[model samples]
Target chain A: MKEPGLEQPGIAVEVAVPVRRTPLDEISRVKMLACQAALGAVIALAWQAVSGRLVDDYFISNPLAIGRRLVAWIGDGTIFVHLWATLYATIVGFVIGSLAGVVLGVWLGVSRFAARLTNPYLLALNALPKVALAPLFVLWFGIGIESKIALAAVLVTFLVFLNTFAGVREVDRDLIDCARLMKASRAQVLSKIVIPSAASWVFAGLKTAVPYALIGVVLGEMIAANRGLGYLVQFSGAQFDTAGVFAVLAVIAVVAMLLNWLVEIWQERMERWRIVSR
Target chain B: MIELKNVSKRFRKGDEVVEAVGGIELGIRRREIVAVIGPSGCGKSTLLNMIAGLYPPSGGRVIYNGKVIDDVNTSVAYMTQKDNLLPWRTVRDNVALPLEIAGLRRAEREERADRVLEHVGLTGFEKRYSSELSGGMRKRACLARMLLQGAESLLLDEPFAALDAQLKLVMHGLLLRLASEASQTVVLVTHDLMEAVTLADRVVVCTHRPAMIALEQAIDLPRPRDVINVRFTNRFRELYDMIWDCLRLEYHEELI
Candidate 1:
């Protein structure tokens, strides 16, 4: 609302504001989303057209058949059992691995002697392919969620550790010096400066570790498991059900994308200062 | 009051020994503003760091209030040229850091920080992050934090060298007023000869390397001097010329 008496004395005032122009970045973002959706639609249409005409449904599964199978599984509530199993293992392992990695990474990063001492052993463990160790994990933990959890933890740990180490190593020397001059205690320095400085690197490691967590669980399930998404794919493939395999793969893709979206939201919230400062 | 008795700092390279300052004796009286000026890389900064207790002197002792400092001296607040404000923190939070270290309650510290920010002409910028602020604004925030520390002394290393002429004058005026009001001692390391003459009660000129004091001249200018106006006077010009004369001798030595 405008004050009637505050207007220009002689001329009539256009109190109502004129239209505002949309920002360039916002316009470009909308155009990019539209292009992505259109591209996805084109791919689906081409797949549908080639389903029966060029390739048999028994061999390369049709998109429509896979969609119908997805609907059927959702309606019957059968996919939930396997999905919950894989999700439970992945989430549990991810939490444990991330906690251990961040804690150990910071501790070792701060302690020069300790990092030098454990250099060879940490390198050797990371040198071995995590997937190849799934069999050994299965042998040790039996054909249960324990094996999957172990595998996932092993995969996630190294990633978070390396990023955390790098973050700690490159901490701003000037800030640390300032904190010390302020008479900050050792614990104060750790809690106030070190952890907050390393938070971005830690979150980046967590985001990258998401797919590796899923891969670990799937690998363990494939090696030996009674129920999981990996087992679903294996069971359907053995029965020569290409449609079932494709449907399970599609479910995994959607699940991965959804989890990644959630993490991206979290990263945005954690780094809100960047938006304003920039 | 602070006293440096034959203080010197030396660093060892792989095989060579680099002497920064060599056996320089100085005393800073209570509530005095002393500026150390010289050519580039003359160990002026190293001398200030020792005074701040960021580094130990290789020879002799640095005594503050009649006590030798062995570690970080909380009685002094050191401000370098970089400003060194935390990028992730807002201006208010950055200024509140020293109070936080001192364990003041949140409400109490925030109120103090607010008053200091207002005094520094940054009243409405409490929500702005350090990265969002420009160079001069960030320097103001740093000054606010140093004020919050409320230490007995201030060790400033070219804190306004990066600023423009007009801004530097404004900063010099604010610093002089604040330091004199609080009766706090200040040791400044500056590359600008005019800045030394404008602000210091006494100016110490150091030689190029192994920085012994080349000359210690007192600026007998009137109190409460205007930074720009005082520069046009003869007293300020004479002090600047004297300091520059000592530095010019070193240039001739280097040429030889």
Candidate 2:
């Protein structure tokens, strides 16, 4: 026979423990930033010390020389013109390509027949090295920003498209059925359920596509262009100006990081409900 | 308001056809709380899915309000075994989802969601995401969402099967109070016999695979009953034992 209790039968009395709520804090942001800055300083100091002694300055330009080149370019406003050109192509191409990819991917994702029909063609296109099409894009769109934009758009499209397709396909079936039971229209299901559910994946695709967009634009500019960072790189390489090449490369790295950071911020804002702090 | 006429479901897994639920005939009256109790994997959930019209029955028809359910039945709210709450939405937003789908105004939706969240004792946790909630709290949120629908019927598939024993007791009290107050038709599918006896007006026991009705026993316990002390009563134990005896027979048959 089990002893009767207020809440449960034959259960031992549970000790009451008061829970203390405390705010969770990870490694301070300022500390992390300081560490990153220190690491960068250490690398730069090592390079500056070894330059012209252990290795020729022509091979790997000294950080001081690269900094001087960047300062000179900034003083003459040479950096801003080329920076703006590259930024414009990368941003515009990325937005257009991502939007188009989302539409196509979502459409194909929802339609099994359409996805199956275009599977082989999409796979073949994706498998093809997009960098190889740089010359062709320049020939078609010409040496202006159009060629760079077109090349970037093409590269971003395939990457975003594949991710969006997978994301849409990966949406939880149970969530869809739950919505359907709540009298959700097909459009409602897609907008409210499918799209939001696949948002993380879309963000992932966008994040990866950012660098690829820059790569595509730079490649196109390298193949044929009169302005932009790629042209600067090629011109400096031809002149054997290692410091100029390094400065331009450094700027490109910063731009890529800035674009990636923007995507991350957008993802965090949009997916506020997904708390990764477990 | 729900009727299943010879309901059957068979799933084709690769080349083999597995019959989940055999022909089942069951009619549930309006405002009745019916609990279908059976062994695990006895096709109990398949029956509820038919009522909710997730998928059409392989053999028979499921009738809701005198009309056969062919498409997804939006009239009845269903809470599957999984909470199925959208991970990207807060407790308030998740509770307001059905209303949002129905094109309800934001003010009206939030007001109703607030009220329902309070009713489910999730008053201050409205902004918390599903990932942050404990299992019991998530279940309550799901229940609040279901209640906010204001549907005439609710089909719950093992709704509280995942909760701890102490939490389960509390949830039972909460559910009994709500169900009695609202008087909505509820079809609860659970393998827990005690739970079936506690909240259900009638308990329907099902057999093994290709589940058929083995026993349908009415719980004659008085209303306004305390879920905690009710289990200690002689009548509750008798009902539990009776259902267990029938369920034990099914298990023995499965072994043989």
True contacts kept of each: 0.64, 0.87
In model 1, pairs of residues that clash are none
lDDT per residue (tens digit) for residues B174-230 in model 2 = 777776677789999998888999999999999999999999999999988898999
Local accuracy of candidate 1 as per-residue lDDT tens digits, A35-57: 88999999988988887889886
State every prediction's TM-score relative to the real structure. Answer: 0.87, 0.87
Model 1, which residues run further than 4 Å from truth?
A1-34, A49-56, A139-142, B11-18, B221-256
DockQ of each: 0.48, 0.53
> Whole-model Cα lDDT per candidate?
0.88, 0.90
lDDT of 1 by residue, B161-190 (tens): 767788788889989988888889999998
